[model samples]
Target: MSLAVALALGTALALPAVAFADADDSDNLMRKKRFGQNTGTVTTNSNTGGHSQESGSKATTETAVISDGAITPFITADGAAAMQAVADKYAAVVAQGGWPKVPSGKLKKGSTGKGPAALNKRLFMEGYLRAEATEGEYAQVFTSATEDALRRFQRNHGLSVTGVIDGPTLGALNVPADRRLATIKANIPRLAEYSKDIGNRYIVVNIPAQQIEAVNDGKVYSLHNAIVGRPSRPTPVVMTPLTVIRFNPYWNAPASIVEKDIVPRMTSSGASKVMRDMNMKIFNGVGGPEIDPDSVNWRRAVVDNYHFRQEPGGSNAMATAKIEFNSPFGIYLHDTPEPHLFHTGSRFYSSGCVRVDKVAILIDWILQGQDGINSSRIAELAETKERLDKPVTNSPQLRVAYLTSWPTRDGVAAFRSDVYQLDGTGFVVGQPLPVGETQGGKRYVLKPIPRSLEAVDADEAVGFASIFRRSSDRIDASERLPGASSKSTDSLVSLKDPKAKLKAQGRDTGKKKSKAASNGKTRAWTGNRERSASEVMSMPDADGTTAKKPGSKKVASKKAKSGDKSKTAKAKADEKAKTTKSTKVVKKDKTEVAAKKPDAKAVTDKKKALTDATKTASADSKSATQKSNTAKAAKPADCKAGADGKLPAGCKPAAAAKKPPAKPEKTAATPAKTASSTN
Candidate 1:
C-alpha cells in the first residue's frame, strides 16, 4: 500500500467497534429505541439511501485522523508528497457538494437532537466516522465517537482543544469546502519551492500554526510553542543559517523603536525616569559613543539618529539568550521574558522576530558540536546576568514559512486562519452561517492575538558591548564568579562596603590594560554607575581615570615634607641670588625712566621714595626682647605700689620719669628679618 492509503486506513480501523448500546445503562440517551426491533445491520453489501457519495462505498472511503500520532517534518520531500495527496482529496471533496455543516450548539456525549445528527453526518463524510459506527441506531443520538472526532477536527484546524461543539468549533465546521481547497492550492507552490535540498537537519517555523519543529535526521527531534509576528508586522519568509548565540544579550533598540516607541514615552513621561527605570541607555550613533541619557537635550528636538540600547538583565526585552542569523530584514530568534504567552492557542505577538518557548532546548540543539555548551553549561549561562557572545560553528538551518493549511504526519490537512490574509481564502473564527444553512459573501475578520504592546528591542546589536565601551555593558567578561567571597575572590571587595570596590576599580592591569588601550588612550569600562560628586574621591570612570573636584585641597605626600628640610641650604643660596638680580633690575629701570619720560619718571621716583621709607621704618622698629630688658633695668628691686598712685619703689613720680629718651631709631638701611618689605 502507498503511504497515503496506509495513513488513511487509521481512520477506518476506528470504525468497526462502535456498538450503540444494550439498553443496560439507564442514563444513556442512546437507548431511545426498543431493543427487540432490528433496525438493520450495515455491511459491505448492504444498500441504504445516503446523503453524500462516500456513504455508498464501504471500504474505499477513509478520512485522515489529523490528531493521530506525529508525522514527517513539514518541509521534507515525503511531507510534500503527503500534502499533494491531501490536496487531491480536498479537490475531490470540492467536486462533490462538500461536507455538511455541523450545527452550532453545545453537544457532548448523551446529547440527542438535530445538532448531533448533523455533526455525525459531517464527521462521517470526512471519514472521521464509518457508516458502521451509527448502524442500526437512532441517527440523531450523540455518541462518544462524535465527541472524539470533533476534537480531531479542532486540533487539525488550530482551534482550542475543547471537545464539545460550541460557537468556535461549529465555526470551523461550517467553513465552505471550496475555501479550504483554495487554501491548500495557494500553499502548494510554497511547499514545492522549499521541497528541494532542505538539509537533513533544519528548523521549520510554521507562522500560521505558531509552532516550531526542529527536524533532525528528517524527523522532528524537538517541538516548541512559538510566538511569531503579528498581522501588522508579519514574520517574513527567510532561509538562513544560525550564526551566533549570545548569552545574556544586550538588546540594541532599532531605529523604528527609537522613533515609534522611545520617543513617545519620553514625550509623555520625563525622559530621565523612563530610561533609568527601563535600564536603557542611549548611544551617539550605531557603534558610536555611549551617551548618558541624562545628557541628551530632550526638549530641543524629536528622537532621531541615535541608537537606543537596553542593558542586559531580567528587564531586557530579549531576556537571557538571542540567536543571530543573517537576513535582509534584520530578523532573528530569541527568548522572551513573557513566557506565559505560550499557553494561548493563538500566539502571534512579536514585531518581526520569533520568540521561542523553552529556548534553552533550541540553543542546546544548535550548539551541539561546539565545546563547553551542553545542558548544564547552558543553564549556567541562562542564570548569568553578564553579556557574553561567541560564534556558532555548528549552526543549523532555519526556515520560516507561512501556511493556512498544513498536512500533518496523521495524513489530514489542518487549517488555520489567514492571519496575514495571505491566502485570501474564506475561513472564519465564529460560525459563518445559521444552523443547517449555507451562504455567499460571508465576511471573516482576522482578529489579533490579545497581548499588550511590548517595548521592542533592536533585532541586531549596534556593536556596543565590544566597541562602545558602555559602562553598563562592561560586564562582557570578568571571569564571572557566582558571587563574592568564595575561593574565586579576585579582589578584596565587599558588597556592603564600597571602599574595597573603589580600590579595585582603577586597577586595570595585565590583560585588561592591553585590551582597553589603543594609541595611548584607555577605553575600558568599569561596569559601575557613573560616579557622582560624593563618589568622586575614589571611583574611576570608564577611562580608568578619576578627577578631584576643582578647588579641593589634596593632602601632600610625606615624602614632600622630608624633601623640604633637605632643600633648606638650597633656599638660602637662592635668596642671595634673587637679591643680586633685583638690585640690577632697579638700576636698569631707573636709567630707562630717565631716558623715556612717559609717566616713567613719576613711577621711578615714587618707587625709590617708597623703598627708602620702608627701610627707615623697619630699622626703627624695636625688638620685643630689648623693650623687656629696658623696663627691668629701670625698676628698683622689691618695689611696691604707693597709695598715692605714684611710683613708690623707684621714688620717682610717673610725670617726672623721663621716657628713656625715646629709643633712637635703629639702622634705617636694614630690612626686618621676619617681615620682608619690597619696593
Candidate 2:
C-alpha cells in the first residue's frame, strides 16, 4: 500500500466507512471523465429460469461524444448533450475560485483536497461540519480527510449518509451561491419590521423551517430548531416586548387547543401524568369546572363555557417555564422535554407557541452568558441532575416573527412552503425595504386601506350629506371664532334651541364683523383712527381720479361732477335743519310727550330733522342740475361763474324748474353700546 493510503487508514476510525468508499468511486469516475476517456458503458442482458442465457466474451465498446470542449461517454444523442452541459458548468465553477480539481500526490491524514476543501467550507458555513480544534498538524484536506467532512456535511444538510459529492450535493453547493447571504440581508430587514424597531436582544422563531435564533448584542448567540404551532393552530406572528421571565412557568393549556387535540387523547388515557411530570399544578375540580380526564366529551367543548388551564408549578400540572411579554399574541418561547421533535425538518406541529430545542442555552443567552451557568450547568440540567431553582437575573427582549423565507449568515436563502398561505399578496416573502415612503419623520406605507362607508352602510347617501353639512357648519364657526368644541355638543345645542333662526342670524352677524375686522387692514384703535362715516365715504374720490368700479379707471370729469352734487345736497340739508328746528320749537308740548329721555328724544327728533334734511338736499341737488342745464342753454354767452358769483362777459338766464319732488327720511340706526370684559 502507498504511504498516502497508510495515512488515510489512521483517520478512518473517527469517520463513517461509507463516506470514504463513496468518495473513492466519485473521484475516480470524475477523474476518468475529465481525461477525455469513455468511463461508463450501456448494456441490455437478461437471464431467467424460463429463458436461456448466452455466455460469451463479446465486449461492446462505449463511444465518446464530443462537443464544446467536453466529451460524453456511453450516452445517446440527447443524454450526451445534457451530461456534457453539466460537466462544462462544473468545470466553469471550478475555474471561478469556487471549487478545486484533485491533484496527484501522496494523500495526507485529516487533509482535504481542492474539491473537498471547497465542500468543507460550504459545510462549515451551513453549520453542519464544525472545527473541533486547530492544534492538529493534519489541518488540511486530502482524500480521506475530505471524505470524513463530506460525510458529516451530508448528514447535517438533510442528505443521506453517502459521502459522495453527488448531483444533488453539487447543485446545492454551486447554483446561486449567494443564497445564504441574500437570505441574511433580506431577513435582517424583515426582522427589523418584526421588532417594530430593533431591540437590544430578541427571540426570533422561523416557523415554517422550524428554527429559532436568540439574538443579543446584534449577534446570534444561540440557535436551535423549534417545534412551533401546527397548520390548524398556526403560531401567530407577534412582537412581544419582554419585561419579565418566570422560572418553572405554568403551561396554560389554551381551551381551543385542549378541546381539539389534548382532550380526545386524555379521554383515551386517564389523568395522564404528563403535566405533573413537568412540575405543574392541576385545577381538575377547581371552581366547579370539572375535567373528567377519561369521561369528558370533546364534542360539547366548543359550546361549553368551562375552561382548563395548567396551574403554576410546585409539582404542578403545567409547563415548567413561562416568559411574559406585552403582546396580545399568546406566544412564548419555552422549553419542552420532548426534544426529539427538533431532529425533524418541519417543526410547526405545536399548539400556537414555540417549543425550543435548547431551552437552557437560550436562557443563558438571555442572561448575557453569565458565569456559573456555563456548559456544565446546561449539561446538568439536560441530565436532570441539577434540581436547583435557576431564575433569570434580568429579562431579555423577545421578538417573534413569521418568516416564510429566512436567510443564513453566509447568504443561503431558505424558503419554507407557506404553511399558512399567509402571504396574501405574496409580497411579504422577499421585500427588503418597507413599502412605505418616509417623509417628515412619518412613513406613508401601504396600510390595508379601509373600505369606504358607502360600501358598508345601507343609508350611505344620507350619512354623507349629514356629515357634509356638519363640516360646513364647523368651517363657518372656525373661520370666525372658537369653533364648536365637539360635533355632538353643537348638535345637541341645535336640537335643544327654541329659536334656531335667531341664533343662526346672530352667529352670521358675528361672523361678518369678524371677517371685516380680520380683512387685510389692522383694527382701528381710538387715538390712531378718527375717520367718520361721511369722511370715509368721500375719501375714495378725493383724488382727481374718478372712483370707478374697483377694477375700472374713470376720468376726473365724472368725479368732479359727483362731488359738486354732494356739496350742493349738504348745503340744502343744513338749511332744512334750521327750518325744522323752528317749527319743532313751536310744538314743544307734543315733542316732550313723544320722547322723554334725552337719548330717546334725540333719536325721535333726528327723524323729523332727517325728513326736512332730505327735502332741502333734494332742492340743492335740483338747483345744481338746473345750473348745468342753463350752461348748455347759454353756451354762446360764455357763462363762467367766477368767485364773484356772477357770469363773466355776456350771459343768458337758466331754464325754469320742471317740478318739485317729495322727500323721504333715510334714518340711520344708532350704534348700540357693547359691554365686554376681558380678564
Model 1: per-residue Cα lDDT over 1-679, one tens digit each: 5322332233222211111100011111111221111112112110111000111112111112112124446577665667788888877877988988776678988899787888888777665776755555757888878777776776666555556876767777888878888888777766765554567778888777777767777766666667777664566665556778888777776554554445545644556777776677777766678776655544223344566677777466667788776544456777776665566556666666788777877777788847877767777766656667868886778877766666765456777677766564433121112111122333221221111222111111212233434333322111111221111223445535665554457543232333323212222222211223333333334344555543222223233433553365455455456654653333225633343333456456656765776755555554645787898798777555567655554555335654543333434334332112222
The residue pairs that clash in candidate 1, if any, are 71-409
Candidate 1 stretches greater than 4 Å from native? 1-72, 297-304, 424-679
Assess each prediction's global lDDT (C-alpha) against the native. Answer: 0.55, 0.39
Candidate 2 lDDT, 1-679, residue by residue in tens: 5322332233223222101000001111112111111112222221100001011121111111111211111111132233333334334444554433333333333445454455555554444445532114333553454566555433323343355666544544554434323333333334335544445566666665456655544444444556666654455554434544444443445443443344433433333443333232334432454444323332222312444444442322113344444433345666553444455545555555666654655555565555476545554443442234444556554545555443222222333445654443322321111212121222211121122222223222222334435433422111111221223232323634656644544454334444333332322111112322322222222123322232112334445555665565565555455544543232224533333223556566656665566666667767877987986786864576779888766665566977644332222211111000000
Which residue ranges in model 2 land beyond 4 Å of their true spot?
Answer: 1-192, 266-304, 311-319, 367-394, 404-424, 427-679
What lDDT, from 0 to 1, does candidate 2 have? Answer: 0.39
Winning candidate number (lDDT): 1
TM-score of each: 0.52, 0.35
State the lDDT at 297 in candidate 2. 31
Among all windows of 10 consecutive residues in model 2, the one with the lowest summed lDDT is 17-26
